[model samples]
Target: MLFGAIQALQIITFEPLLLQCNLWLLAGIALFYLLESGERTNALRRILRVGVVGWMFGLVLAAVQILPTLELIPRAVRGAGFDFDTISSWSMHPIDLVNVVVPHLFGDPYTLDRADYWGESFHRGREGYLVSFFLGAVALLLSILSFLSPRRNLQRTLLGLTLLSLFMAAGEFNPFYRGLSEHVPGISLGRYPSKYFLAGALALAVMVSLGLEVLLIHEARGSRARRGVLAVAFSGLICAALGLGMHAYFQSRPHNLEAWIESMADPKRAAAKNFPVVASQLNQSLRASGIFLGLSSFLVLVSRFWEHPRMSPVLLVSVLAGELIPANLRVVPLMSDRDVEFVPEVITYLTRRGPNEIYRIVQLDSPLQTFSGIWAPNRSWAWRIHFTRMSGQPMYGIMSGLQYAVFYSVDNLNTRDSDELYGRAFRLQGADGLNFLGRLNSRVLLTTSEIPYPGVRVMAVLPTNTDRKLKVYWLEQMSPRAYFVSGVESVHSHKEALERLSQPDFPADRMVILENSGVDTKPGDEGAGNARVLSYQDRRVLCEVDAQKPGYLVLLDSFYPGWQAYVDGKEAQILRANYAFRAVEVPAGKHRVEFSYRPLFFYAGLALSCMGLLFGIVSIFWSGGPNGFKAVLIYLKSRHKKLKAKNGLLA
Candidate 1:
């Protein structure tokens, strides 16, 4: 369990918390059942105990990552407020529920040259859920049959879980979901509620297996076979009618189809060129659905006449494969291998820099616009613009050993600061905007469109012949990474510091904003100081500073917690300056200044994990075999009692 948790944290991109939440819920359910059973079965109790220990072990194993993440989340944008409309953007459509049986109702757009119909919505007009909720036609029928089996308790539990998951996946459509998001601590943190489909899928699988077993082992084989045949026949008729209705619906919506095809071809006019191709794919999907349902019905009918023990199971498996495999094939081609080596000419131009020179580059693509455009693409060119915004150019900076002024991550610790700086620099266009970038040592600006600014010269026009060319600009008069400011002004709040930064003659190079309260400094003390960076790394910076009198040395790095400053190996206070940058006070004289990241919580969590591991190992050796687990429990109980008694005495 510990190993699985660590791997999930590292690999899973979509929903990192889904697996943990499901496991926790399952453990709680199991414990509840064990307590309610009244038998107190040793086997059941042992299983529950093992589950609890495994969960604790996993939590301990991931404590280093978990601790910092918890501290950072509450301060993040998403965690600070819960937006219902934003969360509902990824909700599953009610009609998409039919995908559980027939997945290719709309042809797979990813694999096919073009889908019969397409929308710029989530999953390209398909369901937004991670995995299709398809349980196969036979599995669905069997799951319905499982309710009639003798295992009523198990069936009820599985059904309850499935219903609960589906309700959660509905997002804004379900009232219960809104309540859950409001009350549950971590539930609202999940961006996509459709991720709950994972729990539904698991429950469906278990129920399907139980249903299949029951159908294959009934005492009255003939009666059961007859019932199966009737059920399949009725379902087949319903599916055939639905398929025909869909065909008619598509025929009536030809204008929508033509518009979609035209958008793909020209992106400007509503004149369809590949109408025949689109029509052909739609017809193929309709025919395929009809044929699969017919074949499944025939197989079930044949089983009624045959009394062989294995015939029903074999036929069911064959029907399931036939129904599901082809639907899956149409979508498999969408996942093309990424060519990591395909660097564009514009990127190549920016990678060329002097060994000793350090500067930051700001990409002109607005993150706010990009996030908004992701959901609402009403214009023909919106798709292309959004794609460019979501590209990996910012990540390329790291690979090319260049510093990008803007950086984002799933757990963006410096989101508020970064957003403020980005908004001031790129979003607001003027001399003040230019100065904002200059203060952060941004020497280059990359843009998709022409942005004219003073002191910025066009460095290169990448792929000059192409319509979608990347323009690179060389910015002049940017500040150095580390600089000495002789004068300082104490600001009570971040708002005041930001307002000061916008002043035309703000003396950004001469003075720094010290956010600490009641700090006294002489305005006329213009000390002679020089600071030169000796070494620079991602989390650590070393500099040599010589100040004739007391002054402040400001570093143009995002002011984040856990970064500690040291002057000649002695610790010094790090103050927030210019709203997002770091500053440290230096006494008169030449000395080495170093800034290093040392997160206290991570180390504390690591130490606790180590101690817990040692205790587990010691308990195993002391108690011997499976009894070791019980011995550990006993020890914990005794410790709890002692702590309670000591608390009482203190009280």
Candidate 2:
């Protein structure tokens, strides 16, 4: 139940990629159980049965989140899944393997200046999925030692998984990954194949633990212990040699060193101050790898030479800590409280506004960077790919509307709730695109560039730390958050409505484009009716509409599943208006029109979760002995068959 909750919470609160990691962990456990041998077969079966039951229980526990997610999946940007090129974009470059032992082979941005580091992908206008794949030289040595251990099944399962993970991380570079992506059900659901490194890292950690067990139990003076020591020492020599060789190869030719620096994304940096720092980074990392390996070798030798049982474990732990501590520290960039406190002037101006009305803000320049890393294939190239770091340079001055109550129409981070039809309307180029923002109730536009369009007034121009200034513009033509539209244009589909909205002449404020027919949108007084928002919450919105004549009360919010409309305490059908917003037909009188999120799928899932919880409690009671659950299942099946037979005779 806890695991399922964690998985569901991860999917809801965090990126789906994290849930993939949890699935991989489950796969590893299943593999471990499947590889079990000898007289433990019956025990393994019982354990597997419990695991299966627990898995189902977890699913039921998470059904509330899952059901809503399933409903949203088809409408989401990635509903159709990702193409091969996109799925494999951030795969680990084969050369990144050096980081397996020498983590700083690619200079860490955390430890060094951004321009000082030169990773492989950045030159190609791409960034790696992870900063480091360091498993520690001690861990690597133990993983190697596991091959010689007597537990064949355990060794094979872990090592095989580790190897497979490496291949999968290779992504497009590996034909096996390509085959798996095409044939495997869940493989295509994930992107950035380099993330598979987590599985390999986990497998190696487990193998290290197992190797430690073998080392601790064996006689220090025994032949097996000696062989293990020899193996460790030999592996250290190889790591040291590889490190030295990398440095030596670069030093062999002046052009090799120059070419390496020149290949960086920033050519000016390559020629200027960053050249020497970039050149020495790899060399220093190699030397450090050699130093670490040599130290591990000495530590292992001391553990072997010493007769004490605790000596081996103590020294091994010390060696592992020595390696891991520094590497882990470099993973996170050190920042002062001042840096955290620093807020852009533009952001400060926006957040300091009165809370009377709710409207969205659009960051015109940095739409791609919105939500941090949610990318869609259908998204325009102007909305840059998430993998590209723009040559390690800061692209935008202020990432607006990320956290504050200020919402953004185009780039606010909620991925599933985004309506593609409305997105398509906004993604239309030139003036047509900016026009759609008004329809979305976007009042303010935060941009680096000045808008040439009419009615877009410059509200404020604040100087930023960068070369560019942050300009805040007020859009005068924007519609209210909730308004009553007199004109309703019925369309056949979302495509037709989108096409109509794409035209600059479309009066989106006074008119609504609804896909559904039979809405009693009686011709309203063009300028008579008024709608005032009484409340606007995340899940619910209440508006008082005084319609002079029956018309549509159009709410400039994304029309999604579970949002119900009510007029004067009576339920009313909400029409998909203006490509992606909600529309309810109001009568020619003062009426309370409420829009509330009450998804049936959520309630259905809640009911299932309750049932599952009750079933789990019942099963716990029935689980009287080791084989009691199995016996209960057998009896239930027989009883079901007998009841079926009696029903058939009655029929």
Candidate 3:
């Protein structure tokens, strides 16, 4: 995309604004080829041979990568470490099972929004389908142009370069370059430039075929002049290959990798905490300039020894092998699935809390970099792939509205002793502010305790005990002006905060906040005949409900061993693992939203999507055969054979 964008700008543009955002980088590069012609030379065969030699070098790199991959190396680059833990992927299958009977599940997003969770994914599928079709068509055309173009003027050379750029671009941007992300926008970058490495393969193929043809036409004869450039390129390629190899090896090493992996084995561990630090260490070595510099330096050193053909090819091939190896294993270990001591209480709170309810996710930055490695790993010293694992990089987190709107670093988890962290800062202004308020999920109360700002008054303790470890606190303060603004952002009024957390139904006998705790099995049921008091975990709770359950109790991974859940009074099912939260199956009715981390079912949905995708791709492409165009003929032939088999069976 970068190359394409660059090329597009070079061409005519009535307005410069297009260059900033709407520019097509790849298209410009394609046009660059159309305008240039090959230089005529009698040593065509010799030129072809050189190109072929370069390609063979690429093959050697591929070999290096393939050997390890075939051996099942855990850190094998290309297709390794693909994660899709986002909201869109998990809610699919569970929604589908419910929708199967509902029948009103399929529709456009606007219409389907009311259907349920499953409806949204398929509805969104329409947009994704369109995007994928567009992307596939573009990839196909680029591939064809490179494949069919003659090797003269080294048209293949330019084609190879463009292809490399596009591939590298894809590798950098796409989540899983070959599989899932191919359908998305330009891929993000990583530890290794995948697209560029893959392009090297195509370049090798081109160079080899052209070189062999040239050798057939003319015997090998050449004066070794610019062996320097060749040497430098070869060296860089070699370093890249070796660097990635070492990285993968160290990252997957038994001692280093196992320690992190073991950490995650505990259900109490947060997947974010157990990230591999060794991977980061190696990433620093694989820095972009490292390869380029190493290669260049080596070439300069070996420039004097390049006269012999045998020596030259061997040296060049060694470099090529190095480059190819790293190129092929382009997977970057930006994050790993490791375990950390997960805050159990936090997870419980999130699960128990209703949907869209807000809560502060605090990280204390004073003693150390809290949540630093987990949220983002330090890959700064590494090569600048467009997308890298930088420390504290803003993440896309989903828990409650707090995860959505703003992330707090100086919020409700700390204490300022007796000196007043807020009072000292605001004393210069000479006036105390009104007490700030945050409506959970709606307007968040921006308290001095929560944000460490100027105006606040001491209130009391929450969860009512020091032993519980809840970050809740009590405070009173004022700030009509400060409330108007908090930091660079504005703050809503007290009334607004209450309104945010309150239901739109206005006056209620009592505010019925429907939490998607997934604890209650009977969704959409009422609060009719239920026990008034119950006890669990040394706490007394009251349950009141009607005959019709009218809410979503999605107990995502809220499973704790031996834990039993009841709605109103009836016991619910504990269908999955002990620690994992389960979403309670709601009965039929107009309901509220509550959910938990019942993920095993989500994985089942992903499996189904994968199967569907595989089927679709295979069915569409199988008929395209060796000739590449006779899809219809192949289809007819297969159909005929199937029909014959059916007839024989009947007989």
Candidate 4:
């Protein structure tokens, strides 16, 4: 029960890709159980039954988060899976294997400027998906020693898994991984193939522990010692040769320290111009790694000469601590509150102006601006602002807004409708784009570039310590969060609506574009309607609408599942409006409308979870006072036999 709950909790909190790790651990447990059992056949069957049942129970326990996620996946951009090129990105290059021993050969992204990271998968200010994959020189040597130990079968299994993980980590470079990603069912769902390196790292750690046990406790002295020394010597020679080659390559670059330092100030030029710094760091890392390697190798050789094998643990621990601790420290970047905390004047300006108003703001600056300094200027300030959701390029949530006029990258978590609308909205710049922005209820736009559109007031020009200046523009004709639209333009489908939106004169401010054959909630006067948002909360929104005749009350929020609309005391159907927003029909008078989020899947999942909890409790408390599983099985068998007899009598 505990195993099932823990596994369920892991899936609930993190990506489903973590199931791969859980599977590996489960396989290990099964193998250990089989190895220890005298009656292997019976043990295998029993353990398999228990494991399957436990896995199923885990799914039930995780149903709460899982069901909602399952509902969302179909609407998500990556629901089906990613393309091979996208999924295989951030794969570990075969050349990056050197980093296992010489960590800073490519340079550190966190400790130094991200530009200093001269490695693969560097794009849009992100140096790499993974920065480091160092497993220590001592760990590597000990892992080699594990192969020579008596538990050759276990060692072989470890070696196979470690190699397989490394091959998978190679991703695009490996033909096998490429084939698997194309043909396999779930392989394409995972991104960043270099993440598989963690599995290899885990395997090596286990191997090192086993190797230490063989050396210290088992005392494999003569032949094992000779083989270990030979293996370390051969590996050390190869690493030394690789280091020399790298040194020669870095040596060819021009070393103009002052010039490189000056060029590092420019974010765009930093990566190319800062090669000298990277080269210098590489040289230092090489020297330091060589020293550690030599020291550890020396200790291993001396341990063979030492009479007492018990001292082997001391030397092993010392070598690992000396090499690994410093590498660990160097890879992690520490920041104080001053480094992360800052509020820009633009945000302060927005907050001061009608703080209670229900509206959203978009930051139009490029995400690469984060590379301007050690960190992005006032990036964390986005968290403090209410109603206004701010982000640059890598928008997190579904409602991070159509901040960018055109998404330059495909990293956004956008619906097909919103993506189409935003893409076309960029082409419809000037008046049309402004109208669309107004329809989105975008009141303020903070950008590095200046806006040249009409009715856009220059709110402020925020000067920062760097060369860049943030220009804040406020839209004068922007609509409120909730408003009554007298004119509702109906189309057959999202495709048709998108085609219509692409036109030069799409009047988004005066009318709402909905995907339907005909709109019934039309006002008698076509202009006798006014609506305002009474209150806005995370899960609910209240609005008051006044109309001379029946009309549509449109809310400029995402038309998502689970949100229900009610008109006064009666339930109302929420309609999809303005490509991806929500709307409901209101009668010909003043009335209050409420929208509350209460998804069916979430409630169903909760019920299932409660049932699971009850079963867990009953299993713990009942079933013959001891051996709960056996008692439950016996009760199930008796019930099955009774049901069989009753069916025979009925027949």
Candidate 5:
């Protein structure tokens, strides 16, 4: 139930929070359950059964999404694992614990100019760690109180989970995370260890609830109330001291805010213009911290001096609301009308070009980077900008409903051949590079700068809502989506094929490489057969070919598993040609060739899902009545008797 609730809430954004929370909950439950079970084997078995059922329920519920993901994940870059250095980039620091208790200690990093300036210098653009895990001082105090509750085992288990999450969140700052990533199977899938903070937050929430219940007990006498007051007072004093110390440290720094602002007036130093704004926000945070501490102290005094039970709960609730509501408001600001204003002209223009036209558009400048200002920022201002710029480019193509040559996603399956093609088109200069783009069926090129390619004609100069200009060029000789080649060349390796492709006069349209050494074909047979594309679709292609003799028909499509080819209604072997495309041999005379994508794993998963659904329905019907248990026993006994009779007959 907890996992389901978390998953449903997290559907708004697919982050690792739910996964972290689920891991913590399951581990804590299993550990506590095991310890409590002791020598009782039946108890242990019941716990294991319940756990298994819950896990299987989760799996079955998510099978539709999981099945397709399993098929595609192995083909992605994340399948191998991320580099340690990259994964550690978002790690938390030991000092960042202050922020967990005191939230917005430096200021809101998601805003345009609110981040800790000094922290960014040493933390590689990260303003501060633990900013995302802030639960306020009130929650912190409650969590501490949970330790003294009667439910010792549950509290201890939660505390252990909290510590484990904190250690993992520290990433490279601690050794445990590194060791776990190396030894564990799915642990390496997480790029940001700080995401584990969600588990810590979940544990703390439970602890806070337990603690609050203890405090709210009406029967609590004078001493118990006094102790609670003392705890709150101590927490407030500590927070006050921390805030004052932080302010002193910032004041002692040699960098002068006035001078920094003056320096940014120079056009060359415009990048530092936001520094002053950040400094002001930091000062504001300092003031806010002092106010929070003062309020906490006042609440502690009220709880101690006053005896009314109703008043204590009311004051505590008011104080918590006062602290959290502003924080929430600051983090999530109202959206402006301009936020939704995108480049409609570009979308309209692309839509006007018939959707069935099987050609791709290549954007010279990554749209994500170019349109970073439009996307929501992250916890760290610098990282927010970087992430938005890197990931936003694909949105342009998606919004316009236009096929783009370059795409990026969590599961990016960029093969070596595809990478080479992309690099040659973008990095290489002159007509050779432009010709490669044409061969890749990129009919349109969108760039922020001019290119001196003769084959491309300037179509339009479109203006974006952000006041940026985009130059659109149309390639005169874009290749077909599915083409054929009559001649075949035997290449020993990808390197050899690449070398052959680099030649000035290499006939990309006429000749293609056959990787298998067994398939002997002469490179000189360039015009042995003729081929034309008859129909083209997203997953299926049809072509008509006339071969003078035995020749190969090559299609300019990435050769991946599950793609099958047929020639004249007979199944044919699909070879990986030109290092990354598909090819098939055809007999003499006219013949129809077809290519279709049909993954067997997907079908198998669908069948299994159907079976599971049927079984669930039958179980529900069979277990509906009050005598369901007796019915089940009888059914099992009958099955056992039938099996015994069958065995006896066989004997």
Candidate 6:
């Protein structure tokens, strides 16, 4: 809003340079503070200093978000065999959300939706709207009462502080979007790391501090206001004491702590994978509660400084809400996943496949409607039956030459017995569904999985002779199976699909057996003990004499227990690479690649950058921040009035 309002204002005046409005704002705010606080400081210099400091702070957060430290990632593991940085660019939506709400709440929550909302009256998904409304109205009402009260002395100061305390505590408004005139100066010190909604709470905190500071100054300046100051201060103390007591009784962070118990109690599966349904519901509740924590804690600190009798009663409410953002949000990210596990793959496959093969798929799914529906006509195929939702004809309305692949099912493939959710992606076309022709060229046919057709024909399924050969992608392309461009050099011990490479002729290149070949066991524990033996079995490499290609090749002397092979850079499936040792038919040219596992630094960097942002946010509201905001304000106000008056006559 600050930006938008300024832009609108500038349009009337027709400013010279458009984007550099921050300079203008700096000048304006400095002047406003000067006028409001009464000339007690240097206008220009102080204005520039505060502006630079605040902007620099924001810049630092931006840099950290873009930096490479994986601070953004919630979890990092060594040797996990997964990389997040195979692609460029860190996802910013999650980090941005926390950037707005964290400092106030002191915790970050998880959300899959990518958005950065900054508004005084904004709510994502849902908000305790009624709760927020009541708090805000009461706060505004208290502030009005104080503002209307006469007497700028210590007595008035106490009332003023009470009002400010109420404003900060009530928090249904987002203050970060405002200009320098919105809230206290250092209130948003570390604001960038938090979500925007917390800005409302932060703004209110500034008011609390300002009111208290004014009261302190008023009492200090001669007069018999000292006892009144102590009374107000003492009253604030009581409020603080009561507030803490209430917090202890009412504030309990939303936690999935029970997840641990449930996982252990479920004797059926591992906690790493299978989870009880209760954990999911708990996660949602935690997300909702987390939003409140940010608002509550902020209220607590502000109350300690500004305890007006009226404000004291409300302190309990604000403290509780502030605590909500931190408590409930801390666990939110644990559960948010914006992209479904299967969507990215569907997009990739649609982007890569060819026309004819897709046509064949259409024939297989909706045999009656396919132009060449001779093959797989009955639609009684296992894959089709499990995948398609409809029973008959309408599935082929648009799949004449282009196959309308309805479902991409994993359940139909290897885990048919497991009853997983994947079998529904691609199946036979149903009677009710209208098929839309996908825009894909014939090149996609080259990237088929176990079905391998069009340009990719499966030679034979030799499950006995293990040999998995293929380049490994740094980031696993989440899909039902591996996709290769017809250079069929994959032999997974786990998959029973016929192997057929671009070059069907087996390369007679020799393969080498590399293994640590060791056994770990205690003395005399060789029986059924923790000791195991590794008996070397004969392992060999055969190829169509790729003495023509440039890679190491030698027949393996023996297969050690944990031996595996890769034709190029890709790592083979466990025990599967235990044998793609059959052959490698590379284009007769020099190729460079390695088999060691590498980490995904790109994603890691994104994670770290976000984490830094998180830290920056928490640091902003460290309570009793760097002082002298009044000085900065005094300077700006003087300059602003003079500049406006001088320019006002001409306008």
Deviation (Å) of 371 in candidate 5? 7.9
Candidate 6: worst-modelled 10 consecutive residues by lDDT: 472-481
lDDT tens digits by residue: candidate 5, 1-651: 334333433422334435655666777987777777766787778767766765565455455455655666676565566777766767876756766765554445554433223344324454444444567766666676665566778889989989888888888899777777888766776577777777888888899776666555524545765576576667777777777676666567525643553442333324534555555655556656666666756665555456765575576667777777787676554444334345455556666753346778777765334223443334343443333222224542354466766544433346546656666566657787777777667788876668776888887776542334567788887666655566777888877876666555767767777886486665546567777788877788999988887777777778877789999889999988766678888887889999998877666666655665565556655774755755877888999999999999999
The 0-to-1 C-alpha lDDT of every candidate, in the order given, reads 0.64, 0.67, 0.31, 0.69, 0.64, 0.29
Once all C-alphas are superposed, what RMSD does model 3 give against the true structure? Answer: 22.3
lDDT of 6 by residue, 131-194 (tens): 1211232222223222322233423434443333333322223242233213433232212112
> Which candidate do you rate higher for TM-score, 4 or 6?
4
What's model 6's lDDT at 394?
22
Per-residue CA lDDT of model 2 for 72-96, tens digit only, reads 7677656666678777877887877
- TM for candidate 5 is 0.80
Poorly placed runs, candidate 3 (over 4 Å): 1-25, 32-310, 313-405, 408-435, 441-651
Candidate 3 lDDT over 258-320, as tens digits, reads 454334233223232223332343243344324533553454345445564345334434554
Better of 5 and 6 by TM-score: 5
Candidate 1 overall Cα lDDT vs. reference? Answer: 0.64
Q: 4 or 5: which has the higher lDDT?
A: 4
lDDT of 1 at 319: 74
Q: What is the C-alpha RMSD of each candidate to the true structure, in Å?
A: 9.0, 9.1, 22.3, 7.6, 7.4, 24.0
Tens-place lDDT per residue, model 1, 127-219, is 244545555565676576566556667777788777877887777777777887778776666666777777877887788777666555654
**Which 10 residues in a row give candidate 2 its minimum summed lDDT?**
385-394
Clashes of 2: 0
Which regions of candidate 2 are displaced past 4 Å?
A: 1-24, 34-37, 40-44, 110-114, 122-124, 220-225, 238-258, 261-273, 336-344, 351-356, 367-430, 518-525, 610-651
